[model samples]
Target chain A: MIRAEKIFKNFGDQAVLKGIDFTFEAGKTNLVIGKSGSGKTVLLKILVGLFQPTSGNIWYSDINLVSADKESLRKLRMEVGMLFQGNALFDSMTIEENIRFPLDMFTTKTLKEKKDRVNYCLERVSLEGNNNKFPSEISGGMQKRVGIARAIVLNPKYLFCDEPNSGLDPQTSITIDELILNITKDNKITTIINTHDMNSVMEIGENICLLDKGKLAWQGSKDEVLISKNEVLHDFIFASPFLQKLIENSK
Target chain B: MNLNLFYHFGNFVIWQAQIFKRPENGSMYYKETVRQMYDIGIGSLPIVFLISIFIGAVTAVQFYYQMAGSLIPAYYIGYIVRDMTIIELAPTITCLVLAGKVGSNMAAEIGGMRQKEHIDAMEIMGVNTSAYLILPKLIASLLMIPILVCAAALIGILGAYIASVPAGLFSSAEFIKGVRSFFIPYNVIMMLVKAFVFAYILTGVSCYQGYFVKGGSIELGQASTRAVVYSNILILLADYIIALILTA
Candidate 1:
C-alpha cells in the first residue's frame, strides 16, 4: 500500500495539488480521475517521484519517499514500474530488446536467461511472435501492450501508469484496462493509474479518487459512482448529455 | 544577460557532477561508447575529408600568390601550410565544423528523447539518465575527435601538395623540402591538446543543452541551435587561451 499524506504542490504560486491525503491499496486498480488540469497528472508524478510536492509525505508502505536518500531511492525505483502516456518504448529497439532493457540494466542474468525473460514478457502481453518488430511497425494498441510488457518485466512491487488510454479507441482502451487489472491482481502489485476515461472508471476502477481543481472532491468505488451525490464527480463523469441521460435512464 | 549566464554556468557545473558518476553497468556503457564512436567518428569522415582538402589548397594557393617575387622562397608555402594546418586550422576549423554537425545532432537526439518522455521512462527504471545518455558520447568524442583532427592535418598537407606541386607553382622537391624544414614535433602536441579540449566543450555543451530541454519541437530546435552556437564560441575561446598558454 502507498499512502500520500497531505501532499501540497505549488508551481510558482499556482497550487496544483492542495493537501491531498489518500491511500492506494495493494492488489487493486487504484484510479485517480478528474477533468483536464485537475491535478491528476501532477499528483501521479509526485507519487512516482518525478515531481516533489511543495509539502507533505509520500509513504510507500513504511518508507517516506519524500525524504529517501539517493541510494534508497535508487533501490526503491527498481521495485517500481511506470507506463508513460506516450508508451515511451525506445523507437530504435526491437520489441524483444525493449522488454529486456530493465533486466539487462539491473540483473546478473546471462544472455540466454535474459532472452528467456524477454520471451516470457512478450508472451504474457499476448505479442508472443512479434519479437523482432520495432514500435513503429506495430499498431498503437500493440505498442501499448509492449509498454505494459516492458513495465512488468522487472516484477515491480508498485506500478504507475499515466493516461494509459489517452489516444486509444474505446475498445482498445478497455482491453488495456483489463490487462492492467489482471496484471495488478496476478502480481499483487500496488497499481495507481491516472485517467479520465469514464469507461475505465466504470469498468475497472476498484478504488477511485476524484480531484476537482487541485483538491480531492470525491472518493469511492465503481459501484458508488452511479449513485454518488458528489457534484464534482457527477459533472466530470457525466459531462456529456448522453452519459447523463444513460445514467438517469438506468436509475 | 549576466544573470542568465551565471545561472546556466552554475547549472552546467552541477550537471557535470551528475554525469560523471559511476556507471550502473560497465558493459552497457561500453556498448554505447562503441556505437557513439562509429556515429561521431566514421560517420564524419567524408565531410572532414572534403573540408580539410579545401582548407589546405586555399592556404597554399593564397600564400604562394602573396609570396610571389618576395624575398621568401616559394618552398615556404609548404612549410606554412604544414604549420598552419597542424597548429591551428586542423584542430580549430575541424572542431568548429563538428560543433555544427555532431554537436547539434547530439542535442537534437537527446532533446527528442526528452520531449518524447523517454528520459522520464529511463529515470523511472532507475537509470541515471544524464550519465547513460551523455557519457558514451563524451567518451566517443574524446577518443575520436583527436584522431579526426590528425587525419585532417595530414589530408590538408596532401591537399597543399596536390594544389601547389601539380600546378607548377613550385617543383615537388621544393614543396617537400619546405614540409621537411620545420619539423617542430611540439606543434603536433599543441594540435592534439586543442583537439581534446574542443572535443570536451562540444560534447558537454551539446549534451547539456539537450538534456535539460523543456516544452515542444520549437524549443528543441532552439536548444539544438544553442548547442552548436555555444560550442563554437567556447571552442574558439579555448583555442585562443590554449594557444597563449602553450606558446608562452
Candidate 2:
C-alpha cells in the first residue's frame, strides 16, 4: 500500500495539488480521476517521484519517498514500473528487446534466461508471436500491450500507469484495463492509474480518488459512483448529456 | 544574461556529477558506447573529409596567390598549409563542423526522447537517465573526435599537395620537401589537446541542452540550434585559450 499524506505541490505561485491525503491499496486498480488540469497527472507524477511535492510525505508502505536518499530511491525504483500515456516504448527496439530492457539493465540473467522472460512477458500480454516486430509496425492497442509487457517484465511491486487509455478506442481501452486489472490481481501489485476516462472509472475503478481544481473532491469505489452525492464527481463523470440520461434511465 | 549564465553553469556542473556516477551495468554502457562510436565517428567521416579537403585546397591556393612574386619559396605554401592544418585548422575547424553535425544530432535525439517520455520511463525503471543517455556519447566523442581530427589533418595536407603539385604551381618534390621541413612534433600534441577539449565541450553542451529540454517540437528545435551555436562558440574560445597556454 502507498499512502500520500497532505501532499501539496506548487509550481511557482500556482498550486497544483492542495494537501491531497489518500491511500492506494495493494492488489487493486487505484484510479486518480479528474478533468484536464485537475492535478491528476501532477499527483501521479509526485507519487512516482518524477516531481517532488512542495510539501508532504509520500509513504510507500513504511518508507518516506519524499526524503529517501539517492541510493534508496534507486533501489526503490527497481521495484517500480510505469506505463506512460504515449506507451514510451523505445522505438528503435523490437518488441522482444523492449520487454527485455529492464532485465538486461538490472539482472545477471543469461541470454537464454532473458529471452525466456521476454517470451513469457509477450505471451502474458497475448502478443506471443509478435516478438520481432517494431512498435511502429504494430497497432496502437498492440503498442499499449507491449508497454504493459515491458512494465511487468521486471515483476515490479508497484505499477503506475499515466493515462493508459488515452487515444485508444473504447473496445481496446477495455482490453487494456482488464489486462492491468488482471496483472494487479495476479502479481498483487499496488497499481495506480491516472486517467480521466469515465468508462475506466466505471468499469475497473475498484478504488477511485476524484480531484477537482487540485483538491480531493471525492473518493469511493465504482459501486459508490452511481449513488454518490458529490457534485464534483457528478459533474466530471456525467458531464455529457448522454451519460446523464443513461444514469437517469437506469435509475 | 549574466545571472542566467551562472544558473546554467551551476546546473551543468551539478548535472555532470550525476552523469559520471558508477554505471548500473558496465556491459550495457559498453554496448551503448560502441553504438555511439559508430554514429559519431563513422557517421561523421564523409562530412569531415569534404570540409578538410576544401579547407586545405583553399588555403594552398590562396597562399600561392599571396606569395606569387615574394621572396618566400613556393614550397613554403605546403609547409604553411601543413602547420596551419595541424596547429589550428584541423582541430578547430573540424570540431566546429562537428559541433554543427554530431552535437546537434545528439541534442535532437535526446530532446526527442525527453519530449516522448522515454527518459522518464527509464528513470522510473531505476536507470540513471543522464548517465545512460549522455555518457556513451561523451565517451564516444572523447575517443573518436581526436582520431577524426588526425584524419582531417592528414587529408588537409594531401589536399594541399593535390592542389599545388598537380596544378604545376610547384613540383611534387618541392611540396613534399616543404611538408618534410620544420616538422614540429609538439604542434601535433597541441592539435590533440584542442581536439580533446573541443570534444568534451561539444558533447557536454549538446547533451546538457537536450537532457533538460522542456515543451514541444519548437522548443526542441531551439535547443538543437542552441547546442550547435553554443558548442561552436565554446570550441573556438577553448581553441584560443589552449593555443595561448601551449604556445606560452
Candidate 3:
C-alpha cells in the first residue's frame, strides 16, 4: 500500500538515494536491506514523512508524503506506527506509559480502555508484567520488545521498523524477527523493515529489496535470494567469507 | 550533524505561536508551567535560599568594612542589599542557576528524546511536539522565575538584616525605612519583566538546542552543554538590554 517513485535524496556532495523505485504490498514484510550508509534509514524516513525527498514522490495510497501538509501528515501519521532503531522509549515514562503514548495522543479512549490496550500490546511482545519499569532498567532485548509493542499500540495500518536488530544478539534477533513476522501475519498490516541482517531476510522477509549505494541492486523473496546467480547480489549477501562458505555448503 | 541556528529560532517562533493560538494548547502551557515550577523552583528552593542568605550575610560583612561606623547611614545597608539583589543578583544569578539546572536539563531531555525519535513519535501521534514540549517551558519560566527571584530577594534582605543587627549596625525600623524610602513600583515591575525575559532565554534557547539534537546520545549531551553556555551568555545580554530600558 506504499509506493516510492524515482526518489532522489542527497546530502551536500553525496547522493544518498538515487532514482529508486519500489512498491510495498499489504499484509507482508517488505524489507530494505543494505550495508551501512546505504540510505535505508533515509528512504524509510522519506516514506514516513520525516524527511523530504530531493526529487520524486512517495504515495501512501494516493497522497504524496513528500509534500503533505502538517494536518495531513498528522492524519497519515496516525495510521502509521514506527519502531525506531534505538527503541526510543521516553526515559521519563514507564513501559506502560511509553506503550500508551500514541493512544494518549491519538485516541480518546477511556483510561480503562487505554490501560487494557497497553496490557495487550505488552503481552503481545512478551512484556506483560514490566509495565512500571523504566527504559534504563530494562534489558536491550526487552527494550526492543517494548519498542515493537509501542509501535503497534495504536493498531496502525502501516508499520515501519528501522534496524530492529541493530543491538540485539543473534538469538534475540531471530526472536524479534519472528515476533515481527507473527505480528505482521496476525494484523495483516502493511509492514516494512529496514535491516542489514541477512538472517532476518531469509527468515521473515516475504518481499526483499537490496540497496547498494543508493541503487536498487536486487528485489526478490527468500527463495529467489538464495537461488540468484547475480554476482553483485552474491557478494552482498555473502560478503563475509564464513557466511559465503556456509551458504555454499548448504547449497 | 547539520545545525542551522536561525532555522531553530524560526521553529521556536512557530511553536510558541501555535501554543498561544489555541486555548487548549494555552491551558496546557500553563499546566506545564506549574509542573516546571515544581521542578525548577520548589525543588531547588533550599539551595537558592541558602545561597542568597549566605551571599547577603557575607556582603553585609564586606560592605561594613568600608561604611560600617562612619558617616554613611547604617540603615543604608538594607537599601544597598535591595538595590543589588533586585538589579543584578536576582535576575542574572537566578538565570545562571537555571542555566545549570533547567537549561541544561531542557536541552538534554528534549535532545535525548530527539535522539530517540520520541519527538518524531509525538509528531506522528498527531500531537504538536513543539507545543507540548517548549511552550510549557516558556510558560513555566514566565510564571515561576519571578516567584523564585522574589523569594531570593526576600531571603537576601533578611540575611543582610541578621548579619548587621548583631553589630548594632542598624535598628530594624530604621532599616525598614531605608528600604522603603526610595521604593519604585516600576523598578519591581521592571525586575519582574527582566526575570521573565531571562527565563525565556534559559528555556527558549535550551529548548531550541535540545529540539534539534541529531545523531545519538553523544550529540544530545553536546547540545545540553552548548545550550547552557549559549543561553547563559544570552541571559547576560538580556540583562544589559533590560537594564538599559529600565534605567533609561
Candidate 4:
C-alpha cells in the first residue's frame, strides 16, 4: 500500500494540493477523481515522484518515497510502473520492443525468455498478435493496451496511471478499466489511477478519493457515491442538467 | 538578460551532470551509441561532401582571381586552399552546418519526446532519462564529427584540384607541390581540436535545449530554433577562443 500523509504542494505562491492524507490499498483500484483544475493530476504526479510536494510524506510500504535516497529511489522505481495519459510508447520501436524495454534494461534474461515475457504481456493486454506494429499503426485503445503491457512487463509492485481513459470511447474505457483492475488484483500491486471519467468512477473505483479546489473533498468506495450527502460530490457527479433531472425524477 | 544567460548556463551544467551516471545496461547503451554513430556519420555524408566541395571550389576560384598577374606563384592558390580548409574552413564550416542539421534534429527529437511524455515514461521506469537520451548522441558526435572534418579537409583539397588543375589555372604538378609545401603537422592537430570542441558545443547545447523544453508545439519550435542558433553562436565563439589561445 502507498500512503500520503499531510501532503501539500505549491507552485510559486499558488497552492495545488492542500494538506491531505490518503491510503491507496494494494490489490485494489484506487482512483483520484476531480474536475479540471482540481489538483488530481498534481497529486498523482507528486505521488509518482515526478513532482515534489511542498511538505508531506509518501510512504510506499515501509519506505518514505518522498525522502528516499537516490539508490533507494532507483530501486523503488524498478518495482514501480506507470501508464502515461499519452501512452508514451517509443514511436520508433515496435510494440514488442516497447514491452521488452524494461526487461532489456533491467534483466539478464535471454532473448527467448524476454520474447516469451513480451508475448505474455501482449496477450494479457489482448494485443497478442500486434507485436510488430508501431504505435501509430494501431488505434488509440490498442495503444493504451500496449502502454499497459509495457508498464507490467517488469512485474512492478506499484502501478500509477494518469488518465487511462481520456481519449478512449466508452466501451474501450470500460475494457481498459477492467484490464487495470484485473492487473491490480492479479499482481496485488498498489494501483492508483488519476481520472475524471464518471464511468470509471462508478465501475471499478474500489477506493475513491475526491479532490475539490486542491483539498480532499471526500473519500469512499463507489457505493457511497450515490447515497453520500457530500454536496461537492453531488454537484460533480451529476453536473449535467439531464443527469441532475434524472436523479431528481428518480428521487 | 545576463541573469537569464547565467541561469540557463547553470541549468545546463547541472543537466550535464545527470548524463554521466552509470548506464543501467551497457549493451543497451552500446546499441544506442552505434545507432547514433550511423545517424551522425553515414546519415550526414552527402551534405558534408557537397558543402566541402563548394567551399574548396569557391576558395580556389577566388584565390586564383586575386593572384592574377601577381608575383606570387600560381601554385600558392593550392597551398592557401589546403591551409584554409585544414586550419579553419573544414572544421568550422562543416560543424556550423552540422549544428543546424544534427543539432536542430536532436532538439526536435528530444523535445517531441518530452512533449509526448516519453522522457517522463522512461524516468518512471527507473531509467535516467537524461543519460539514456543524451549520452549516446554525445558519444556519437564526438567520435564521428572529427572523422567527417578530416574527410571534408581532404575532399576540399581534391575539389581545389578539380577546379584549378583541369581548368589550366595551374598544372597538376604545381597544385600538388603547393599542397605538399609548408605542411604543418600542428595545423592538423588544430583542426581536430576545433572539431572536438565544436562537436561538444553543438551536441551539448542542443541536448540541453531539448531536455528542459516546456509547453506545446510553439514552445518546442522555439526550443529547436534556439538549439541551432545557440549552438552556432557558441561554435563560432569557441572557434575564436581556440584560435586566440592556440595561435597566441
Candidate 5:
C-alpha cells in the first residue's frame, strides 16, 4: 500500500503537482491518468522517490518516504521495481543481464542462481531464447515485455510503471495492460501505472485516480468514474469524440 | 567575472566524493576501476610503447643530424632520447595518447549512460550513482597510468637506440654512456609523479563532463568533446606546473 499527502512539486516557478493526495491499495493495479503536463509523471516520480517533492510526504506501507534516510530509501528501492517509459534497458548488456541486474546489485544470489531466475522470468514473459539478444535486436513490443520481466524479476513488493503503453499499437497495448493486470494479481504486489490510455483505464483499472492541472480530480473504480457527473472528470473522460458519442449513446 | 567557479569546482569535487562514500558500492567501484585500468593501462601499452620507441628513434636520428657538424659526440643521441622521453614524451605525450583513448572512452561510456537515463535509474534504485560509477574509474586510472608512463619512457629510449644503432652512431657502450652522462635521477621520478597526476586529471575531468550532460545523444557527444577539450587543456597546464616544480 502507498499514500501521498499534499504533495507539491515544481520546476523552478512552474507548479506541476500542486497539493495532490491519493492512496493505492495493495494487490491491485492503481492507474494515474492525466493529459500531458498534468503532473502525472511528476507525481509518479515523487512516489518512487526519484524527485524530491517541494512539500509533502509519501508513505510506502508505514514508512514515510519523505523523511527516510539513504538506507531506508535503498531498502524501499530494493523492494521496488520500475518499468520505465522507454524500457531503459542497458544498451550494452544482453536481455539476461538486464533482467538479472537487480539481482546482481541487490541480491546475494550466486551467478548460477541468478541465471536460473533470469531464465524463469524470461520464460514467464514468453521470452525464452531471446535472453542472448541485445535490446536493439528486439522489437518494440518484445522490449516492453522484457522491461516487464525485468521489473518483476526481483519479485518486488511494489511495481511502478511510467507510460508503459506509450508507443505501442492498440492491440499490443491491450496485451501489455492484460499482462500487467495478470502480473499484479499473480504476485499480489501493489502496482502503480502512470498512463493516458483510456482503453487501459476501461480494461484493467482496479483503482483509478484522475489528475487535472496538478489536482486530484477523482479517485475511485471504473464503475464510479462512469456514473460520476463531475463535469471536469467528464470532460477528461469524454474529450475524444468517439468516447463522447459513447457516453451520449449510453444515456 | 564573478562566476563562482570555485563553488562549481567544489560542488563537482563533492559529487565525485559522494560516490566513494557508500560501503555497498565499494566492490563494484573497485571492479570498475580494475577493468578501466586494464583497458586504459594494459590495453594501451602497445600503442604507447610503439610511439615512444618511434619518438626515441627519431630523436636520435635528429640528434645525429644536428650534432653532425658540432664538436658534440655521436652518443649524444642517447642523451636526447633520454631527456625527451623522461621530460616530454613519457608524461605529456603519453597522457595525451591516453586522453584520446581512455578519457574518450570514459566520456562516451558515462555519456551514453546519461543519454539513456541509466544514471537516474541507478539513483532511483537507491544506489549512489557516483560510488557505483565514478570512483572505480578514477581509482583505476590513478593506479595503472604511472606504470604505463614508466613503460613509455623505458621503451621510448630503447626505440631511439634501435634507430640510432643502424646509423653507425654510438656503439652500444657509447650509447649507454651518453644516456648516463647527464642523467638526473629526479627527472625519472618526476615523470612518474606527473603521469599519476595526468591520469587522475584525465579520468576525473572526462567523467565530470559526462555526468552532468543534459539532452540526449547529441549532448553526450558534447560531453565527450568537453572531456577531450578540458582534459587536453588541463594536461598542458599541469605539464607547466610539473615543469615549474621540477625546475624550482
Candidate 6:
C-alpha cells in the first residue's frame, strides 16, 4: 500500500497539488482521474518519486519514502515499476534488450537465464516472438505492452502507469486496462494508474480518487459514479451532451 | 555576474560528484565507453584531419610570406610551423572543432533523453543516471581526445611539408632540416597537457548543459547550443591558462 498525507506541490507561485491525502490499496486497481490541469500527472509523478512534494509524507507500506536516504531510495526503486506516457523504451535497443535492461543492470543472471526471463516477460505481455523488433517497428499498443513487459520484468511490488490508454483505440484501451487489472490481481501488487478514460474508470477502477483544480473533489468506486450527487463529478465525467442524455435516459 | 558564475560553478561541482558515483554495472559502463570512444575518435577523425591539414598549410603560407624579405633562414619556416603545430595549433584547434561537433551532439542526445523522460526511467529503475550517462563519455574522451590530438599534430606537420615543399618556398632539405632543428620534447608535453585539459572542459561542460535540461524541444535545442558555445569558450579559456602556467 502507498499513502500520501497532506501532500502539497508548488511550481513557483503556482500550486499544482493542494494537500492531497489518499491511500492506494494493495492488490487492487487504484485510479486517479481528473480533467486536464487537475494535477493528476503531478500527483502521479510525486507518488512515483519523480517529483518531490513541497509539504507531505509518502509512505510505501512501513517505509517513509519522503525521508528515505539515497541507498534506501535505491532499494525502494527496485521494488517500484513505472510505465511512462511515452513508453520510454530505448529506441536503439531491441525489444528483448529493452525488457532485459533492468535485469542486466541489477542482477547477475546468466545469459540463458536472462534470455528465458525476457521471453517469459514478452509472453506475459503477449508480445512473444517480437523480441528483435525495435520500438518504431511496432504499433503504439505493442510498444506500451513492451513497456509493461520491461516494467514488470523485475517483479516489482508497486506498479504505476501514467496515461496508459491515452493514444490507444477503444478496443486496444480495454485490452490494456484488462491487462493492468489482471496483473494487479495476479501479483497482489499495489497498482496506481493516472488516467482520464471514463471506460477505464467504469471497467477497472476498483478504487478511484478524483482531483479537481489540484484538490481531491471526490472519491468512490465505479458503482457510485453515475449516482453521485457531486455536480463537479457529473459535469466533468458526462461533459458530452450525448453522455449526459444517455445517463438521464438510463435513469 | 559573480553570483551567477558562482551558481553555475557550484552546480557543476555537484554534478561532477553525481557523475563519479559507483556504477551499477562495470561491464555495461565498459561497453558504453568503447562505443563512445569509437564515436568520438573514429567518427571525428575525418573532420579533424581536414582542419589540421588546412591549418598547417595556412600557417606555412603566411609564415613563408613573412620570412620572404627577412634575413631569417628559409629553413626557419619549417621550424616555426613544426613548433607552432606541436605546441599550440593542433591540440587547441582540433579540440575547438570537437567542442562544436561532439559537444553539441552529446548535449542534444542527453537533452533529448531528458525531454523524452528516458533519464527518469533509468533513475526510477535504481540506476544512477548521471553516472551511467556521463562517465563513459568522460572516459572515452580522456583516452581518445589525446590520441586524436597527437594524430592531428603529425598530420599538420605533413601538411606543412606538402604546402611548403610543393610550392617551392624552400628546398625539401631545408624544410626537413628546420623541422629536425630545435626539437624540444617538453613542448610535446605541453601540447598533451593542453589536450587533456581541453578534453575535460568540453565533455564536462557539454554533459552538464544537457543533463539539467528542462522543458521541450525548443529548450533542448537551446541547451545544445549552449553546450557548444560554453564548451568552446571554456576550452579557449583553459588553453590560455594552461599556456600561461606551462610556458611561464
Each model's iRMS: 0.5, 0.5, 2.6, 0.6, 1.6, 0.7
Per-residue error (Å), model 4, residue A89: 0.9
Q: How far is candidate 6 from the true structure (C-alpha RMSD, Å)?
A: 1.2
Across B13-104, the per-residue lDDT of candidate 1 in tens digits comes to: 99999899999999999999999999999999999999999999999999999999999988888899999999999999999999999999
TM-score of each: 0.99, 0.99, 0.92, 0.99, 0.92, 0.98
- A9-121: candidate 4 lDDT, tens digit per residue: 99999999999799999899999999999999899888989999999999999999888999999999999999999999999999999999999999999999999999999
Per-residue accuracy of model 2 over A1-251 as CA lDDT, tens digit each: 99999999999999999999999999999999999999999999999999999999999888899999988898889899999999999999999999999999999999999999999988898999999999999999999999999999989999999999999999999999999999999999999999999888888999999999999999999999989999988888778899779879999
Q: lDDT of all predictions, in order shown?
A: 0.95, 0.94, 0.84, 0.94, 0.86, 0.93
DockQ of each: 0.91, 0.94, 0.52, 0.91, 0.55, 0.89
True contacts kept of each: 0.86, 0.92, 0.53, 0.89, 0.44, 0.89
In Å, residue A10's CA in model 1 sits off its true spot by: 1.1
lDDT of 3 at A97: 85
Q: Per-residue CA lDDT of candidate 6, range B56-170, in tens?
A: 9889989999889999999998899999999899999999999999999999899888988899999899899999999999999999999999999989988988998988988
Task: Choose 1 or 6, whichever is better by TM-score.
Answer: 1
Q: List the residue pairs that clash in candidate 1.
A: none
TM-score of 5: 0.92
Q: After best superposition, candidate 6 residue B97: deviation in angstroms? A: 0.2
**Cα lDDT of model 5 by residue, A221-244, tens digit:** 877878988877787878899877
lDDT of 2 by residue, B1-248 (tens): 99999999999999999999999999999999999999989999999999999899889989999999999997888799999999999999999999999999999999999999999999999999999999999999999999999999999999888887788888898888889999999999999999999999999999999999999999999999999999999998998899889999
Task: Write the residue-wise lDDT of candidate 5 on B17-128 in tens digits.
Answer: 6866864644555566688778877799888988788878888888888888898786777887888889888889889888888888888898788777677677766667
The best-first sequence of candidates by DockQ reads 2, 1, 4, 6, 5, 3
In angstroms, how far off is A48's CA in candidate 3?
A: 1.1
True contacts kept of 1: 0.86
Q: Taking the tens digit of each residue's C-alpha lDDT, what string does model 6 give over A11-77?
A: 9999999999999999999999999999999999999898999999999998888899988888999
Per-model chain A TM? 0.97, 0.97, 0.96, 0.97, 0.96, 0.97
